[model samples]
Structure formats: structure tokens, C-alpha cells
Target: MADTLQREHAGVIPGSRAAVSAAVDHLLERQDARGWWSGELETNVTMTSEHVLLLAFLGLPHDDIRDGAIRHLLGCQREDGSWGLYHDAPADLSTTIEAYVALRVLGLDGARPELSQARRAILEQGGVAHARVFTKIWLALFGAYPWEGVPSMPPELVWLPPRVPLNLYDFACWARGTIAPLLIVISRRPCRPLPFSLAELVLPGTEWRLRRVEASGPFAWADHLQKQYERLRIHPGRSAARRRLVKWIRARQEADGSWGGIQPPWVYSLIALHLEGMPLDHEVMRRGLTGLDRFAVEDDGGWRLQACMSPVWDTALAILALRRAGMPAHATPLRRAVEWLVDEQIVGGGDWQVRCAPGTEGGGWAFEFDNDIYPDVDDTAVVVLALLEAEQTDEVRNAVARAQRWVAAMRSSDGAWAAFDRDNVRQVVYSLPFADFGAMLDPPSEDVTAHAIEMFSALGVRPDAPLLAPAIAYLRGAQAPEGSWFGRWGVNHVYGTWCVVSALAPLHIDDRAVSCALAWTERVQNHDGGWGETCASYRDPSFAGVGSSTASQTAWAMLTLQAGGVGDGVAASSGARHLIDRQSAGTWEEPEHTGTGFPGDFYINYHLYRHVFPLMALARYASTDA
Candidate 1:
């Protein structure tokens, strides 16, 4: 392969083979002693701000921690004196309010230049009165915002069975974990008095009123009734609900002290337990509070918290990239990674079992190191594929078989797979007043379904396999008119199209659709021989596959073209050139966020993307240079 590539295009890119070698060495060097890989999961300043507030709410001292986070927050503020959900995004009212409040809590003077500028940005964006429901709830904690102005998620939701319309399981697992605890906080209405006031956040004439209702009339009316119910202190089933909720929250806390292995649930659950008289010195609270240190990264740049960690996801992807780059399966890093991943498999039950097929024994991987109850189909499928590269052991084989069954059983009714739930396409949940953040339901997405299909194909599952055919149909039905697919977990159309095409290309399924997608990839290629898409594409279809060139999206585009059997085509070759030209020592520098947490609400810059993906694209392109 190296000889053929050299004879054909060495002049066009003399460093192609060298680039692949450098990237491989770089990835090998990145392996941790434990055989896992983790890149910094960077979101906006809201995570850091929330961390500070969480410690404060618990009456925990954050002296130096507070100063470091304040530095990080101030550094992240835009020239407009506001924070955004993603880099270079328009100022988001909720994010600005949260950061401003965090700065205040960290003891920055409201009259300081930074705070004054932020206050102006807040008022310009409709002031604190227009913040999201979640933001308002945070303010209400410190007696800044009125409780009546925030939406009510009554604790009574705990009693609803799975079969009921608004049952606890109806919400996505993350939402379920968060809402269960938040219900306790709302009912308790616990307030921790702040040293100062937020009177400056309210515009001169603006009063606390329900911002323009984002939910349906009926849902809004239901929330109003709940508020009135709270006013009357009417509670027939409140005690039973609270007990169930507390028990439920206590049962799900991971060993690392986080709830659901994410920030929202972790912070909120601690507060809820504290409100219910769980002592700070108790083992659970102590572990939960201190476990947050694992998520914090402090340095010259100051401190920031990850919204969630991604070691399992990062390790699987890194191993797969090495294998794709033609690394031997017996290579030391690959062997260690496979063994570690095999051990990381969750054999215990989780919330997913509620909606999964009957008798679906747990054998899947969670995205985090310790989240046993939330193993996702996406991570499990990818891990299975990576494990196949290594010589299978009895333990590896057993883990694989169990994972296959779990993935198969996780199929939603639409013949597709969601990240954490089966058939979790509850639309009514989005109509609730509290559902302001982007995605409340974990509906089946094309990207995850594609991964599942690819895994089955590698296992030689027949085309007519029960899950295979319907999953293919699901992808077919999901393709946009312009031929791209919607990326649920990644950035946008480019990521989704690459995943689907990469899966279908080997099966020779829907040749016309594949060709159409290939054309779309080519059409969206930037003038500079790469591809990019803004996170805005999630809310605005017109922005699909449109943005400044970045290594990750370019690699996704290159892979899509190669999957369509056009690795030598102009678009693919140029994308390869783009990666080769931009390489330095083995990795590209990517500051842009290419990962999605929630479509319009949260975004992530997986620091490893600049390394793993470009290498995968360049190596595969070189060996398969038709």
C-alpha cells in the first residue's frame, strides 16, 4: 500500500505516509497506564459556574476553587461581555445570566467593569426575566428569582407507572435522574441567602413574569395548576412520592458520587438529599461532593468542570482508529485497551431494562467509567467492534455475546436505537413548561442505528437478521431530501451521513441513497479542500455542512466519500490533502467543538478529535488509495 501510494501521489503530498506514522505514534503515546484514553470534554462556562454555585449551595467552602473558576469564566466571556452555548455563537440569555450570577457568588463586585458589561448584555437580551426555566430555578435557590415564576415538576410524577402517559420512565434517563431530584428541591423550595442582591439583573421596568410560554397551552395550564396546588399546600400523596424519589435517587448514585455520571443530576441529587436531611458528613454526601474533584481540571488556565466524562467513548474510538490505520491487533496498546474495555462492561441492570425487551440481561458499556445503570447502545456497539480486532478470549467472547444480545434487545419500536432508552419517543414530555433545554426524549437517531448495523455486519449477521432489516429501513426513512441525515449525538448532517454511508456501503444497501449522500458531501466541501458544519445546523437546516474548516468534520466528509467507494475521487483526495497539509508532529489543532451533547443547548470539544479522526482518515485513504 505504501509503494502504490508513493508511485501515484507522492508529488501531490510527499508527507502522506509520514503523517500516518506520526499520528499512530501520537495516539500510542496518549494511552494511560490503565489502558483507557480521555480527552478534556470542553463545554461553555456554564459548567464551571454551576460547579461554583453547587459548592456554595451545599455550604461548602470554595475559596481557591471559586477564584480559579471565576478566572475561567472571565476568560470565556465574549467581546460582547456574554457567554454562549458554543464558541462564536450569538449570546445566549440563559448562559449570560448563569455566568453573571456565578461571578457575583465568587465575590466579584457588581460594579466591576466585567460585571457592568455583563449586566448590559443581560438587559439587552431581555434581562433575567427571559432566562430559561433551569436558569430561573438556580436563581430561585438563592432568593433572586421568585418560585412562582419557575415551572413546577411536582414530586407526584414518581408514582406514575411505566404504562402511564407521563410516567417517570417516559423521560430520557438523564432527564429522569435530574427531574426526580429537582422535584424534591421545588417542593422544598429551600433557599440559601446570598450576601448580595441580583436587583441589577432585572431591567429598570422589568418585573418577574412568566416569559413567553415555550410550551403548549395545555401544558402551561397544567403547570399553572401545579403552582396553585403548591400555594394551597395540598398534598395527598406527597410523602409517599418523596420517599420513593429519595430511595430512587439513593439507589442510582454511582460509586464515584455522581448521579447518572453527568453534572445536572450529580449536583441536583446532592442538594435534594441535603434538603431531605442527608448530612454533609454522611458517606453518600461526602463521596458525592468530593467525587466532583475527578471532573475538575485546574492549571494555569484556571479550573473548569466537565459536563460529563467520556473515557469509554474515547478509548473505543481511539482503538478503532488505530485498527483502521492498520495497526496489528496484537500490538501492545490494542491488547491492553481491549482487555480494559472488556472489564468495563456492565453486567448489572439499569433504567434501560424498563423499556428494553423482556429478559434482556445487562451486558453493555456505559460512556463513563462507573455508570453501570446507563450503558448506551452506541458505546456498546463501538466497543464490540473494537474488541473484534483482538484475538478473542473466553472472557472477551462472553462479553461480546452478552453485549450483542443487549444491543439487539435495545431496539426501539421504530426499529432503531436511542442512546439510553428503548422506544423513548415520548413527544408530550417536550410540551412541559420545564422542557426548555433542547431534547428531553432520547428518540432513536440515525447515527446510533448506523453504528448498531455496522456492528452486526462485522459479526456476519445476515441481511435478514431481525434487527438489521428494520434498522436499514429506519436509516432509509431518515435521510433528508438533500441526502444527508440528522446527527443526534455528533455535530450535524456530516457526521450522520458518514455513519450511515460507512455502514451501508459494505452491505450494498440503497445504492442510490448512498450515491446521493456522496454527492451531498462533495457539494458541501469548503473551497479549501475540507468540510465543516456549524453547531447552528441543529436549529437551522440552511446551515447544514456550513462553517469554517475543521479537522474532525473534514475527516467525517473524507470517510463518507471513501465509504461510497470513491477514496480516490477528487473530494476524498483533497480531504486527505487537507489533513496532511495541516498535520504537525501527528495531530491537527482544533478549537472548534465538533461533538454535540444536546442539539441547541450543549456542545463539546473532544480534545482528542484533532488527533484520532484525522489520522483515521489519512491512513485509510493511503491504504485504500484506489
Candidate 2:
């Protein structure tokens, strides 16, 4: 099997030189003089539509950006008159409803054929009454649905201690931050009505109704009991609880006025503050609005808002790609990138400390430019790996050591690292009716574990390091029966398998595991000389490693093949050709959002992935040990 693989990739390098040089030169042009790269992080129209809604709700005057954003939403509408959550995703009920409302609010006549078609599509999907919880909450705010129809998130629940089952601290940082503000919105049941009704989305006689509750057993009982308790507390019997909840939410606000560095929490927090009687011009409220505004970008293509900004994450990944393409780490461009990364390291307490064991100064990187309250293990690992490959200066030395300590302390009892919290494994959080966006708990994942191991290896930690064996055991367990691993943050098995192979190759782990994994990835290669896995793979394993070829997934598969020692021959060359064939003027065209925000709920197109990953692949092919 190994011999066949080797022969297939033989002499692939020389064929890729021109493509490699083009890709590398293109990427070098993208770097900042001070050393960073940020491409737009694109999401579905829901993000842009929702931003319009937030701005309107705040009574902010509609500006040209909003006008451009309106055009973006209209442009993205499917020919069938519905909207989807991701590219090629079937028309989603929640997204269509949101986009339709935002358009209506922005002066698109509800009587227009475009609006009528969307309304029909939404009604066919069971109307706003059956949309996702988040969408339902938005409807309730607009007075389209009664607050009683939505799930109760009583403010008093914030009073629950950490030891309790449903404490806020038990939620992932994103969940807790977003929900804290939502609880305030739900508690007050604000009925801010829109100028016109969206009666078109409803069927002939549909009425607002609360979701039914039916559960058995103790776990189920606790869930129903919460709803029953919701009815008993008319205004959440405790004013102290409200005060503490508000204080808790406000204290975590980033310097930019976002809570936990994301849009949902910021938008919700702004609404919650207004309801709580903070004046519109209040400093905190003003900052939050500015922070959200900063996320918007308008161009000739139209306007869109990143669900979240990712300069720190994108910069690190870009550095790795450029270095792999034969740029010396000591070069000024690369060194500047390293210096910028060291400056972004987290040096103070964040929400992670609420669950983390004490006694370590905080040291890691957050995904956004200004989110200090949350720094993720995955971003930290990526940055550390990139720095190790760069010219190791004094700043890099201090940053890496601090990250190593924080990472070491964050390792779960199972020996793997989760993206956010330590020991945050409560299954009940996900089963909660209000908790359906997928990542309720921050349990360790195979891909995150692989990156941690690779980071350790890059830092020259011994193979005998305490975290190594447990993480290796984790990889062994996560490997598919057919030998692939599941990627939590990337697309699917291809991304996961690549992470494992990258870790094992450098560390010289047992060959059997690596070989089986390599063969599994190779077998799934598309006829186009690439790999493709739909996000549907999350709910159905049969779709795992199956889909139309994508530039990012193809590069990942190529990277895995090279790591397995076929050494950039036929298979690698073919993958490079797919990238080169698809790229125009140095940029690769990829419509599919390859980065996973949440498996079923959200997905992302890291616009840079197409260019960066292919460059990484072709560069390795051009520099193989053949």
C-alpha cells in the first residue's frame, strides 16, 4: 500500500514550480507591512440582515452601508425566493424569515414579488412560529409573536451557584455571554413593534403558541420543572438577582463594548441595556454600537458583516503558509508577522478563569482583535506552531512559554484540550430547549487534540511529556474504524485526518495508525484530485468524506498525502493542479465556507483559506525531500 502510494506521487514536485511561485507571490503581496493578514470572514446573509435590524432597533439613522447591505441581502436571495444558512444549504426557515423582515424594515415593499415569494417559502416551512430559538426570540422582540410563545430565560436563574446543574458558568463562554443578555430581553418581554406586520409569513389563521413540553425521567423532569418555574416568577421575584445578572454581563464587556468578542452577545447586550434603562448615549452602550459597526465591510460586491472578525487567527495561519512556501522566517515580512502575534497574547484573567484552576497568569490569543475575556486553545496552538517556524526572537520566546503553561494547565482529565473551558462537559446543557446552536459544552475534540500535540512537538516538548500519551490515546480513540478522524473546526474527516497525520509525522509515532489513516484519506479523494465533505456530515456519517471538491479541502487532503510520505508525486501534483486550474490571478475561488463555526447551526468561509491552504500544499510539493 505504501509502495503504491509512493509511486503515485513520484516526481510531482518539478511540475508544480510555476503554480507554487504564483501562489506564494500572491500571498506575500497580502501581508501587512507590520506583519498580519486578514481576509473577510464571510457568513450567510443572516449576519448582514441581522446587523441592519440591530442598527434600526437602536434608532440609528440608516446610512449608505445599510443601503449597500440591503443590496447584498437582495443579491444573495436564491432564484426560488428563499435564503439558506450556507452556500447550497437547502432554504432555511429561520434565515429566510430574518432576511425578509430586514428587507421589509429597510423599505422593500412587502407587496413586491420578491417579498411575496419569500413569505410563501417561509410559510411553507411552518412560518416564524417554528423557526430556531434565536429566530423566535427576534420575532418576539418585533412583536410578531407573543413573548409567552418563546422559552423563558428568567433573570433570577443567574443567581444559581456554579455548583448547580444549569449555572451560567457551565455554558461555553459564547453561550453564557449571549444568554446572559438574552435572559434580560426575555425577562422584560420587550414588545418593540415594527412599523408593519409580517402577516404574510403566517398562514390564514395561525396563532402564537408556546412550545409544548413533554419529558420523562429526572433529567427530563428538571427541564420541564424549569418551564413550570418560569410561570411562577412573574418578574423573577428577586431584584438582587437582576442586579447581579446585569453586573455580570456588563463586567465581561470587551474594551470595544462586545461581550466575549462576538455579535450575538453584543446585539443582545445592547438591547438588554436599553431595556435596563441605560441611556443610548451612555459610554458602554456607545462603545458596543461602535464595536459592532467596525465589523461591517462594504465593497463593489456589496456589504456584509463578519459574524466575527479573525485577524489573529488568520494572521497565524497565513504566516505558516508563507513560511511553507519557502519564505525565510527571518525575512522582514515573516518577522513582522511574528512581532504582531506576540503583542496579541492574553496577559490577564478571562472567563476561562471561572472554570480554570488558579495559579497561572493568563497567556493565549483571542480570535478577534479586541476580545480579551475569551482566548481559545485552538488559536493559541495555531499561533504557537507558526511562531516556532518563524525567527524565534525574545518576544516570541516569552509568548510561547506563557501559552505552553496555560495550555498545559488547560488539558482535560482525558488528556486532550477543548477550545474554551476546562472540564466543561455537561450533556444536559445541549438538551435544554433553549440550547440548540450545537456547541453547548466545550469538550475536547480530535482535531483540537491533534493541534495541541503538534504545538507541543513544535516547542520541542519530549515525546514522553505528560500530556503526550493521553492525547495520543485520544487520537487512537477518535480514529474512525476505517481510520479517519472527525474535525471539529474544519470540514470533516479530511481535516481531522490531516491534523492527526501532521502531529504523528513530526513526532514519529507508530506507523500502523498513520498508514491506515493515510489510506483512508487517499481512498476518499475525489476524481478531481481533491477532497470534499459537506457540513451534512455532522448529522450523518454516510456523507462523511463526500461532496464536490473544494480548493480548501483539496489542499488539506494534499497536505495529508504529503505528510504520509508519498512525498509530493502524482497524487500531490494532481491536487496542486486542481488548485492552480481553479485559481485566477493568484486567488482561488471557493464558494463553500470551509471553516466550521458550529456544525449544524453556523459555518464560515475564511476567505483566505482558498489561497493560503493551496499555497501551503503547492509549496510543500515544490520543496519535497525527493
Report the C-alpha lDDT of model 2 over 265-296, residue by residue, as the tens digit: 88888898888888889998988888877788
Candidate with the greatest lDDT versus the true structure:
1
Model 2: CA > 4 A from native: 1-8, 12-15, 204-237
Q: What tens digits encode model 1's per-residue C-alpha lDDT throughout 1-626?
A: 55544543433455777888999999889899889999889999888888888878888888968778888999889888989988789999999999999999888989999988999999998888889888988998998888878778889888889999888899999888889999999999988979999878887767835334445688878877787798785688898899899999999999999999999999999999999989999999999988998999988879999988999999999998999889888888888898899989998899998986677799899999789989999999999988888878898899999999889989889888889999898788877888887678998999999999999999999767877998899899999999999998888999999999989988985899999999999999998889999999998999999999999999999889878888766777778878888988788998888999989898999998878888878888778543
Question: In order, what lDDT does every prediction score?
Answer: 0.88, 0.82
RMSD of 2: 2.6
